[model samples]
Target: MRYWLLGALMVTAGASANTSLFNLLNTGDRVNPVAMMERVETDHPGYIADFELDVQDGELRYEFDVINADENTLTELTFRATDGTLILQRNSKLEADDHDELEAVKLLDRKQLRFSELVRMASEQHEGKLMGAQLEHDLGISYLEFKMVDENGKRKHAFDIQKLKPLPMLQWER
Candidate 1:
């Protein structure tokens, strides 16, 4: 009976070890730019931007820089490494105000925390005021933006923390 239980435990552990979120969510090894570009062009038509693919944090990621004909930043997009799914997309103009606020917040003296940690703290501290939160990265700066709605939903405050530095990107072998 003891041997059977031990065997069952080992089998279960092994099975679970192979079924991580990364494995379940990621279908492919990494995305190739040529392939991704082809797909992007076909899907988005004129909106697609020039992109580069590289390994970051042991995962494959695609970094795209889209500039309009007027030489203004339009959007910056990043795709996941394991799969080509879009992880982040930002419109430069739309984020301008948020970016400025984040920069100001970065100068504050609060203890640094991870994105998840900050969100947890904000949710706990603000409770009913907290709506949603997301980590925003722009021009190599990382910040957290929290959206809070008042009880009447008449007032909204988008709080930002600009000082929390982003984790360094992992170096990949060429």
Candidate 2:
């Protein structure tokens, strides 16, 4: 009987947490996550690998994990809940990839087009909902890989990072 009562209380508490989050969304205390992501991408340009909407320092905020265009770095960006103002931007290095690709990216100049700019061009031409993106060097060529969702499911877009030109869709060997 004690075990059963404890389990019931736990479930009730879980439901209350969900209700509070829902109420916050409905009452305009927080912005929609999807819209927030879109705005962030438009301004910063990176793959959003994760997101969290929670209270920080007693104030609500949205946190996002961004894999930058270089594909060798990760950035954590936190934004205010009420106005979508960026509160913080933190960066970290990624682990090494294939030797050849790693060497190629390292050898390339830093004057190439910005990652956000490449994404904007690809989005304009592809006409789909931008899902995520990353920079990669496949077979000694550096490219920006973007994933998009449309009526036909997901598709990949690869663009030349140096020239800022779109490349053919990669056919992955499944």
Candidate 3:
């Protein structure tokens, strides 16, 4: 019975040894997603709209979408999972929308309240680590929405891009 149990455990460990990057983080591996996100965001200096861990061409990679403060540029960065080295960088020009995202960005820039500023505020106000952030337009108004996690739990916060005031906490469904 002891040998059988040992053999089963070894098989389980072997099965999980080749798990993907997403599973490694989910299973409480050494790498922290928040820290990785912060590193990429700090190095890139833009609004981190989205991120994902996936295997491309048989290699694991972390993909991030960052939009510049002026809302005129969008950059996609991909990093290698093993060493966190940047493998790919692609920049594209964003078209001006009818709602004029650039105009809102310009107004925020005048007040020195860019996307990076909002990320700083979110980290401070929440008194926790930021997981991710995105700039969104609602009803012709721009808002900075962010998610954070600490001892309490995960929470979402939003700030009015124009006024730089914190909005009401969003009621999140588990």
Candidate 4:
């Protein structure tokens, strides 16, 4: 009887622990929010707000807000790549005069190439000097960014490719 009670208690504790949001966020095999944001910035070179992640009903989601150059707040929703599903979403407004502009150029359009294609092109263009490349799609637009080390080994170059449209085809003029 004592063994049975102990086992029952353990099971109950495990169930409750799994349901706890903080515990799940800390223990899950997910990327750290700060590190993820840094990577996003390194890859895209844009301003981002802090975010939180949670698992709900077996799906992982993320929520955050981004401040545009114009200081407008744009809510961001991200789902976990481990399982393709809606993880979480955040919607909020920015205060007036909070905008900051960034330099991101549009390279290709949605109808011209797929996400994978952009990554491939960027990677191939950089070739042996290429360090890494990543692709991000937000607000129905895709951005292909890459990083590479300079010849002097002291500087790193990050490229941001955005504005992929369909009408007049635009190709990367390497």
Candidate 5:
């Protein structure tokens, strides 16, 4: 029941290793990631468990794992990043005991910064493109993780938005 890292959980579920941050725009009109997230959350109506913006199947995509405590299920949704079109959806039923995930969501709810606010702050940092963003927890503490790439190179960073702190820099083995 304890998650060592979100990326680990993802890998076990057959997620790709090509998670390095990159430009989401590819041959179509520029799609705003924040807008895609908002629209996906609205259409799916669940607590975000994991969210990612990365290139998948040779195209940019926004992938989400949304948890519905009421139904005790987690839905994985993938949308085309260039046009905000739903490309894939899969729902996995959760164990009855795992409904406690609401508690994890509440932990993030108590944070000082709202998700959108923190995302913008992360996007504006150091002239890099924000490739992915998600809430990650460790030992009951929750924070937002941002995967980015800039003139330097790919970077993975954790921001304690709850405390309004910057770059706690997590060491995820890639």
Candidate 6:
């Protein structure tokens, strides 16, 4: 009963959609997201292509997807929020079939907007608890993708990497 309430609060109490995640997760006392991200980068040689900080079933966690171009591999790592301990790691080789995605990730270096800027721009007209973000592309057009949740459930907010304008929202399920 307590867990359910805690989960719901964590879900809905994100201080609106445009706010920074440093304020959304309220992790100042429990975890240091920057340090956690640094730890992930140090242990794995790659750039974080995707990231999320969320509470699921009452457990706080950090999820990161690292893309290593040299090794042509994509790695997913989850860390416990309380102590920044590695909880899980999944690695998969980026095959010839994944060339498009690999190239899209490489294009992130050309983005003119910062992550926080993209988040605020994506949420300016929409409202949802910001969950995570990723660098993605469709039909050769690259964008920064964000995951958000509200009473209506999870939805994606994307911004064009070149224009820095909000893209259409796409509804998705758990």
Clashes of 3: 0
How many clashes in candidate 1?
A: 2
Candidate 5: the clashing residue pairs are none
lDDT by residue (1-174, candidate 1, tens digit) is: 999999999977755633432242234555544455455545441233234444566665766544332333456777884567988887665245444334333333234333334544444444233323444445555444454333223122233445333232421111
Q: How do all models score by TM-score? A: 0.32, 0.52, 0.54, 0.33, 0.69, 0.60
Q: What tens digits encode model 3's per-residue C-alpha lDDT throughout 1-174?
A: 999999999866654543332244444333444566678767876556655565678666667776675546878888876668888999987655523444455555567654555667655766544555656677777776676544445567777777777777542511
Residue pairs in clash, model 3:
none
**Candidate 6 structure quality by residue, lDDT tens digits, 1-174:** 999999888766643333444344553455655566667766787667777976667677889888887888989899888888888899999777656556656665455333444555666676655578777778767777777666555567677766767766543454
Which 10 successive residues of model 2 have the least lDDT summed?
99-108
The local distance difference test score of each candidate is 0.45, 0.62, 0.62, 0.41, 0.64, 0.68
The better candidate by TM-score, 4 or 6, is: 6
Candidate 4, position 57, lDDT = 72
Best by TM-score: 5
Q: Taking the tens digit of each residue's C-alpha lDDT, what string does model 2 give over 75-102?
A: 7899997888899999877555433334
What does candidate 4's lDDT look like per residue over 13-118, in tens digits?
A: 7556434533444455765444454444444323443233445576655444343434444546565734434455555565433321122212233233333344
Candidate 4 residues lying further than 4 Å off, grouped into runs, are 1-19, 70-75, 81-174
How far residue 95's Cα lies from its native spot in candidate 3, in Å, is: 5.1
The worst-scoring run of ten residues by lDDT in candidate 3 lies at 21-30
Pairs clashing within candidate 6: none
How well does candidate 1 score on lDDT at residue 135? Answer: 43
Worst 10 residues of 4 by lDDT: 98-107
Model 2 TM: 0.52
| Best model per lDDT | 6
Cα RMSD of all models vs. native, in order, equals 16.6, 9.7, 9.0, 16.6, 8.5, 7.5
Candidate 2: stretches off by over 4 Å: 69-71, 96-174
lDDT of 5 by residue, 1-174 (tens): 457687688765432233233323323575787777667667875667567775656777788777776677788898887778888999889665444444555555565334556667756764566667776656555666777665445567776645656655563423
